[model samples]
Target: MSAKTIMIQGTASHVGKSVLVAALCRIFKQDGYRVAPFKSQNMALNSFVTRDGGEMGRAQVVQAEAAGLEPSVDMNPILLKPTGHASSQVVVLGKPVGNLSAMGYHTDYAPKALAIIEGALNRLLAANDMVVIEGAGSPAEVNLQEHEIVNMRIARMAQAPVLLVADIDKGGALASVVGTLELIAPDDRARVRGIIINKFRGDISLFQPAVKFLEEKTGKPVIGVVPYFQGFRVQEEDTIPEDRSRAELVEEQGWVDIAVVNLPHISNFTDFDPLEDEPDVRLRYVSKGSNLDEPDLIILPGSKNTIGDLAFLNRSGLAAQIVEFYRRGTPVIGICGGFQMLGRELNDPLHTESEIPRLDGLGLLDTSTTFAPEKITTQVEAEVAGSGLFLCETSDNRINGYEIHMGRTELAPDVRPAFTILVRSGEKVFFPDGAVSPDGLVFGTYIHGIFDSDSFRRRLINTLRRRKGLEPLQASDTLLVHEQRERDFDKLAAVVRSSLAMEKIYGLLGMEGPICHG
Candidate 1:
């Protein structure tokens, strides 16, 4: 029998549709059902690579994890990573087809993309007991609704009951819900079995009147009003978070100060998410306009456009400041495009990444990068070399990360390799992966999600603790990213369960399941 499905569509982007879908997936899994998450098309910079070398959006990755499944491209059939304001690198079923403009993609490619999306959806439905589908942006975009496969079209195709969500925190949520229902086709509106007001604050009772009005106006029940919650560590597939104040986090004597330079087109920023969970770590994103405070460590994250973002670093003066920090004993590291930006120079012969043919790098490491036409999107296993200044504390040599870039970096003969590649894309490979400076302070690697490994993250934090003369915490039951996420998923499932009308939600599915406590 084909799996049952429910679609979650937002009134607008970032309306908490992704989080809700993940929560529901966890709820279904906890109540004894084989559940999976699906998103027809995702446009985000945050992405993850599967073991078999397929790349998909991180939102579905989180949802898949909630459902107790490994991330795969089948979960998210289409991923569009924005390369510029108007253009994006379109990846169908986890591999890049080509970069296309907004008009080009919608006008010329939507038909083919829709076919691929449906095929993937049918496969997911056949494999799982239930598939929780998440939509992108809004279905009410009248001009684009005809061609947009991410919203109502997929809902109708799957015959999935729709849960329309609106962010009340953004205001006029009632109007948004009513307007969306009115704007969509009558048949599409009929599929919306319920409504949800997400990210609500204050007493939920105070919003009861509005909820009642919403229900009456749309002829649907306001199934839930999810409160604004914190401390739940789910990776977001939206914009970069603003820089935050340290504010005496972790309840410790001191902090492991870290500054991540937020690039214009930063990608896979979830690399630093694990750092924020550290008990004494003060994780901060240093954007272009923000002041770069002196931190124990500085990181340059992956970028979509190496040359353009590197030039941004130059114009913003972050490059010079980062070099100054490295000279002053601060450890610096870069990943992917950021890895290329740390070299002596970057050469784009075929203009694969950017319009500029060549650009000077930060020159922190003794390396040079050359952009190639082919992109590398693969899972990697490596042994961290004990060569970097702060790497002496590494208790674990085996670390795993994914590479998504189009540049090849070569290290100077005198510089040490940061990590030795063991296996790449299921193939055994023996080669250097990254470069470490002579003093072992500045380093750059192609590894994304490197810090997610507990062994590596804890030791790195301990290294910074030693520098500050703070006592190191012994590793006992430290939470790995995977473990922590499982717990968080349970917590999220609990929160959502209590907030929503569970019986009614299951009623919408036309199926009965056990109701378990959070």
Candidate 2:
């Protein structure tokens, strides 16, 4: 019941802290330990709903999967979802408290949040053999140290050894590490047992000198210099890396082409990670002002701000382009906020999302949505109830995914329901979700991660293939995305274990003996 713990603290945001924690979680699990991933607080737009209908960051969800455990809100007690420039919707233990300004959160919420974090940490420690804690931003932010609930605060509370990580690819890796160590308090600095240089792209031999410099500068062992990795696909914790440039979105060779409209406040884009991994689909993320290409399918992805982003689509002319694509027989599917946008109108009387009281939707589906204070965050099992392009082969229309939204949609009598909700948050339920046009061309659903359902995803792509005069692909060699993710966990663990000083890691965890994996 007494769990050994290690914390991965990064020099700054997006320095690969989340990925490193995931790798260690997998390594510990492979070493025959009951490992769990924990973060006292997480600030991210990409989120996942647990079975109990509690919402938490997807990074912890990935780490939980790597540790071979189901995600729980206790793994992440506090979640900060940014709603605007100065405000965030604070969620404690997987439920929303309110949208509070940064100052208000520090003054009113931090004291109470620390207790919640302590309770969650104790629960995880009691249940697991080991727990991997991840820090947010920098512990060196002196201005927020008094109110900080993540980073050194949690590390000290958990009495965990800290592995300070720096992104060598960002230049001045040594400086960042030294500067961080200098800024944090002496006791917090003492907690840092080692240093890790992440995202090193160049020759490893050339970087050896700098690693030595960091170790000498901070008096901490340079645990590893992880080279920039590829091939294995995992979810990026927060926003897409700005430097992660892609080639032209149109590959011009795939049977079923899909272009996802990337909105300004895009959330849960990980929903399409499965589609991007599929060899048969040529997927692209089309930005708001980017030139549109005629693809077989156009997807309106989930947005954090339904009213605000819909206004952006209309003002930016992407809405017109989407209508044109739909008119020319290109199929369209909207998800979450996107689904709300496809409706006839959206009303926000309570200002739950934004100041706009009402805004006109794309009118693709004969439905209307109204924003409510009650946000629905639940996992669902649904079956296709209406005939549509994606539902052409209805022999197997059962699909499961999670929903996180605040609006409720009501379909018109003429439009058919898209899906029938069979189960919600692990309970029996009967309700209609989304709507389909009479012609069965355009449809919208609030379900995120719907494409993760292998059979349903394959059917969608195979139907597109038939429409394009290509033969329907048989589902003989279908592999579930979750299975592939398990393989990825092992692949990542192997890479990191080879790069890092795993023996020292075990020593730091107060354990010994090299474990073998089959």
Candidate 3:
């Protein structure tokens, strides 16, 4: 049988294209069809390394889980990490090739970009019974329509029927969908097979008229109106700052409140997931305009654009608020770019190279960060600070995580050292990497996945509980929640496998029955 394909295109970014593709992949895989998720390109810092040493966007990683498969770099060929206003770090087929300005990327690399995308498609073609391709941004961006590698062009190249998706929650989704279809060239529009109205909050019955109108006018079927469910298990495609989680609203049960500053370009916030798994603690991701009045602890998460986001934080008054929190004896921690922001000064004078200029840091820690042309990327282990108020309460808990950044930092003489010089490779440990104040209440680290360790996470969470006069939750209870969450996802995939029209979908994917468990 020939490979059949389906594509999910969006009217704009964050419009539920990734989630729709994930659901479809799950449903098709359940019907005994081997399925895989594909995206020609993605612009995100949330990335994961596959077991086979391949890299793919985190969205595809989640979709791969939904499809009962491991992630692969071939699933997402080109990854563009926007580092500044106009500059982006480009990854070609999972490896860092170079950095490019927006115009430079499109004008100089379009031909080669297409070649790499086609190469990734070829890999997906070899592995799966069917493939689901996800489009990037909007298909209707006419200026970018010509050299598009992640949208209709890739769909046409793969010969997949596109499923257009728009978020009803965004308002005027009908017009957005219709307008997107109308704006695209005739050939591109012809590839659309159906449409799905995503994130419908109210009764689906009320939208029947609009759905029918769209189907009638566009001559395309309305496949589904997926309602928003509170417990849905899917990896987020972008940094959604909205207070959508039911888990966040639950009372802490006298547990500690750990508020993490939600930066504009927060990367790998997953570092805090283990802590969220703890039942006795409340992990509140506070976005802009939210009060930081009484957070027992405030965590500054990693950011893709440090200087630019720090500028955002300073302008939004979060910087001053952080200082106030520190003065109040509240534990404030920064990770990666957040660590950089806590320094005395940040020097990025080459405004021609990026958006951030040499700006003053929060100045909580006596340290400074300087940007380098090359990024530091590695996995390592470190021992926590031996002499800090925060460390005094902790036992021997080792930290393990990867570091990815393009800056060098050193502590000022007034501050006590955080982590001792245990190990440093990748050449020249210019300075003692992570920084800690003499008291340990204020600290920063370059590590990305430190909280993945249950013991370390519990120590931090329990500290907050101690400060808040709350009861402590046992570690076993917290891990169980995550186990249940994963099991629920597997169940979700099973449901999709059973309910969808499998045979037709399978036929479209160019695969016959008897899907491999692998």
RMSD of each: 1.6, 2.1, 3.9
Best prediction by lDDT: 2
- Per-residue lDDT for 1-518 in model 3, tens only? 24568898988899878877787777666656778899988989787654434445778887887777877788888888777767778877766777788999888886678887887787788777788889988999999987777898898889888878888887988998899999998988988877877777887678889988998989987776766645445668766434433355347466566788988788877677666655565678887899876877889988878887888899999999999888878888899899989989888765522455788999888898888776666555667754565555355756655667778887767676565435443233423557888777888888777776667777677667766776666776565434655665666555444434455455555557555552
Tens digits of lDDT, candidate 2, 1-518: 39999999999998999999999999888888889999998999899999999999999999999998999999999999888787889999999988999999987888788888999999999999989999999999989999999999899899999999999787878889999999999999999999999988978998778778877888999999898888777688986533222343334433577888888788898998887776666777888667777688999988878899999999999999999888889889999998999999999999998889999999999999999998899999999887867765467778998999999999888888888899997889998988888878898998888899898888888878888887666666444798889889899999999999988988898999346574
**lDDT of candidate 1 over 322-356, digit per residue (tens):** 98888888999888888888899999999877899
Q: What TM-score, to 2 decimals, does candidate 1 have? A: 0.97
Worst 10 residues of 2 by lDDT: 241-250
Give TM per candidate: 0.97, 0.96, 0.85
Candidate 2: where are CA atoms >4 Å away? 241-253, 476-479, 513-516
Candidate 1 vs 2: which has more lDDT: 2
The TM-score measured for candidate 2 stands at 0.96
Clashing pairs counted in every model: 0, 0, 6
Give the worst 10-residue stretch by lDDT in candidate 3. 421-430
Relative to the true structure, candidate 3 reaches a TM of 0.85
**At residue 85, what lDDT does model 1 achieve?**
78
Q: List runs of model 3 lying over 4 Å from the truth.
A: 1-4, 27-34, 48-56, 68-70, 205-211, 244-252, 273-280, 285-289, 349-357, 379-400, 412-433, 479-485, 491-500, 512-518
